[model samples]
Target chain A: MGEIWPLFPAAIFLSFFFLLVLIELFTISLTKTNVFPTLEPAVEILKNGEFHNALLNTLAFVAIGTPLELFAGLFAALLVYNSYWGKSFVRTIFVIPFAFPGLVIATLLFILFDSQGGFANHLFQGQYWLFPKIIDHDVAWRGSKYLALSVSMLGKVWRDMPISMLIILSGLNSIEPELIDAAKTMGAGFRVRLQRIILPLIFPAMTTVLLLRSVEMWKEFIFPYILAGNYPLLGTLIEKLYGFGSDPGEAAVVALVLVGLTILTLVVIVEITGRIKRVLVNSGVNSK
Target chain B: MSYIDRDEIGKRIVWAICVIVMIIGIIAPIYLLIKYSISDPSTMNTGGRPIPLWPNRPTFDIFLYLFRDREFWGVVSNSAIIATLTVLLTSLLSIPAGYVLARYNFPLKRFFLILLISVRLFPDISSVIPIATFFVRANLHSSFISVVLAHTLLSLPYVIFMATTAFEFVPKDIEEQARVIGANRVTIFTRILVPMVFPSLIAGAIYTFLLSWDEFIFAHFLLDTGGQIQTLTLYLNKNLSFSPPQNVLAAISVCLSVPVMVFTFVVQRYMVSGVVSGAVK
Candidate 1:
């Protein structure tokens, strides 16, 4: 009722967070070292191999991971959306991967991709359940940067795709069945129905999923930090600089980069959600 | 979920294939985790030219062995205590905060909203440094209190979002009806709105609990004391270096994930609803 119940608690937490960030920022460049760490050094720092790899690695992660997850999620949503039988049953179990902590998934996959007796390489050994020479030798998945980073992404996709499924499903519920029926009567087959009707209708929700997923991938630290070892992404780089290397200055620069990316994504989310809300209104879904 | 007819053989075929692929995807990691946990730690040479997909021999003794490790249990308890406290504290603060956010508009409301969103989305990498420094300065560094406070900051932002959405779900007419009955805001809140959104609030709490339970960054930096302060997550990561036996590691991982896995399964619908409400709105 009063401002105190919510405002006070929020103020306390926000102040703490802001205070930490401010302190790190000032100490990093403005106070201790240089005048705002001009764009030149920032660019140079970025151009360096270490940061270049991290940035490339992170972008690669977002680029490959987001669409893959969306398709997988949309596929799952399609299966569960219309199925009335045991809907809850499928959902409850299917979300098992969704329920795990990213750290735990990272750990499990880290070992699962182990070189010796690790399933990532060993699972498809001789029998070749799917294909021959699919995985013949023990590839040390976490040994190198690319394999480790990509394998870690598999874990992230598993944990997050179900969420994409849920959001898309919620959006699915908003679509009028009459439209689908009309489309069907017009000689639309399943593929056409999916491409013409379902895809366009669920596009905003899909946008929402991608936006959130992008935000998550932007801040992704645990998966890479744990599974990929010292190789840094934007997420793990800040941690490495601040925590491991003890260089708050470089850490601040990277932190600012992440902050900038996050803010941009947040603005995009606001815009997308605004679009979704307008869509919902236009379609007479929520209306209120 | 599509609306295609159930009797459509073609659609059913696609549906079954997609579901099977998804099921296989979901089961892959879990199957491996369980396989390692139950299998013998040493070599498995089954009819033997190459590695088998599963163990030649599986046993539950790894779990029994893990239960005997007092250090593991200690860290597990630390994880529980912190996560439990985080859930309670986060819910307590989030409820009223959520209520105010849903209903009221005050000075600096826009700023606060922006701040809340940023805080929720901000990577822990940046904020963790200065916060950890401040805690260190206060001499509360690496303590349970420091770790819990750090975790509260992480959970609070999103919990407030979750809470705000939950409160928004309560119809305004309901609150107005209570007002018509001569109820005060506090009475209406605790008596009416609370009950209506209690499940969502609980869902939010469980989420917060799981976050702290699974959190590593804060626990890693904050818990400087090795044996006493380490949470299960930190323990898991630390053990990664020591090269513990595979079964033991798997058992511990299973132990860490089981609570969250079970809780999500039990409250599957509520959690999904909570997510949709928060995200879509």
Candidate 2:
């Protein structure tokens, strides 16, 4: 129905220009190692002890952060949705964290919880004296290796909770009020209404949020770099390899692996999304 | 009547508690920056640390220091220039391409869609090194333009995808009616289609600009032209190493984020709707 000429050039550009990235990936990875894009890099990484720590750190991040973000977002949405007055202002406040740059969040939170004379230490200074040896004094959360990693994970959760709430809130809003009323009329308790009516309706939204969060966490470098000092995630590892190690091949290997993981997850989401739409439509029809 | 009144009271209490918790959780962290940005320098690193919760001697000296610093202004200008160019170029490229995807049936369209989606999957960290090397060889590295182009690569896919959705929402009949009235394709697109999708256009531009603004990895490698070409993110990381004065760092952090927070507050609904359409729906 539309002219082909103008759009054709854009398509060709899409096809061609994107290849430059792929070609660059292949050529750079091979030129240095004289091996395949991932082969030597994978072998070297597996041999390195930090690789396991990075992998474990990444998994811990996703496992702890994803659920915490989702639960907090869901509860926040439910509260806002159920509230009466000033809904718009509440939504505005909910989104404030999304506005912060990653470095800003990491740095500010670091200062907020600084070990000596920081907020946590000052607030808990009384508790420390009252319960000596039982109450551990506010340790430098971002200094210890494991604790630093966990605090950075908390930072990710804090910032990302807003977008997740927004997405889930929209989905929750789309559901018919009549459906929930019907459940209540059927003598369903509050938990039953939520479990039977709300959760299924919002599953697709959760999937979208979770997938986006996972992809983001996979490439999460800035927070860890800013908050955790010398801690290495897969992302910071890429930086160290290229900038410090001067091994673009190894860095390419790490980068491509992350890409591979992301693409694989995305493919699964695509397959599931088709079924989800069908399920929602069929459920609505069957109920009628 | 009594039961309903009690139920209403319970719900109000829950809402009140939720608001309180959210305000404390989100605001308290930001308050840290405000606290340190005005903390007295004498109380920092020299003698016993002042109570960070409440700075006894608060002053705006740090803000004055950064404002006077030449390098801070350079990073600020660099960020503004790159983010501005990114918004303009992303819109120019994405709108037409999105319209095409929405209106026309082209061969390999699904293939192209998947290809575009695949671009989003790959992190910039993965490809930035190779891209940087390629750009350097072409003598394009270490410049504001290089950073803009690199950011566009990350921004374009999301913009194009969102733009396609935005175009689809503009009722087909409006465009069809325009076509029947002797309007050519360009006129119809620019005047009719563009106006209808204006909110989405704004949202897409905001997203693209923010994406470029916050991106640090690509800026790190691509704009390696000494200290002059660094973005705000690079500036922060560069200063982070020196263990710069806490108040100065806090001021820098606040400077980088206040604009973003203001933008988010203004366009909150548009952002939420855009995500719903693009991500879930």
Tens-digit lDDT track of model 1 for B1-281: 34455557666676677777778878877887888888874444333244455776778887887788898789989999999888887887788888888888787778778888666666787677667767777888878888888888888888888888888877688878779989997898888888878778888888888889888888887884342588998888888889777777788889989998877755655754533333222
* Candidate 1 vs. true structure, TM-score: 0.85
For candidate 2, report its TM-score.
0.87
What CAPRI grade goes to candidate 1?
Answer: acceptable
Scored by Cα lDDT, where does model 2 land? 0.77
In model 2, which residue pairs have backbone atoms overlapping below 3 Å? none
Q: After TM-score superposition, what is the CA distance of residue A203 in candidate 1 from its true location, in Å?
A: 1.3
Q: Give per-residue CA lDDT, model 2, range B1-281, as digits (tens).
A: 69879987887887898798888888878887777888886555433333545676889888898889998888888899999998987787788889888988878678878878766556878878777878888888888777887888888888888899988876677767778899998899888788777888898888887888878888998875453588888888777778767787788888888778766655656654533233212
lDDT of 2 at B203: 83
Candidate 2 lDDT at A132 equals: 34
lDDT of 2 at B52: 41
Consecutive 10-residue window with the lowest summed lDDT within model 2 chain A: A127-136
lDDT of each: 0.77, 0.77
- For candidate 2 chain B, which ten residues in a row score worst on lDDT? B272-281
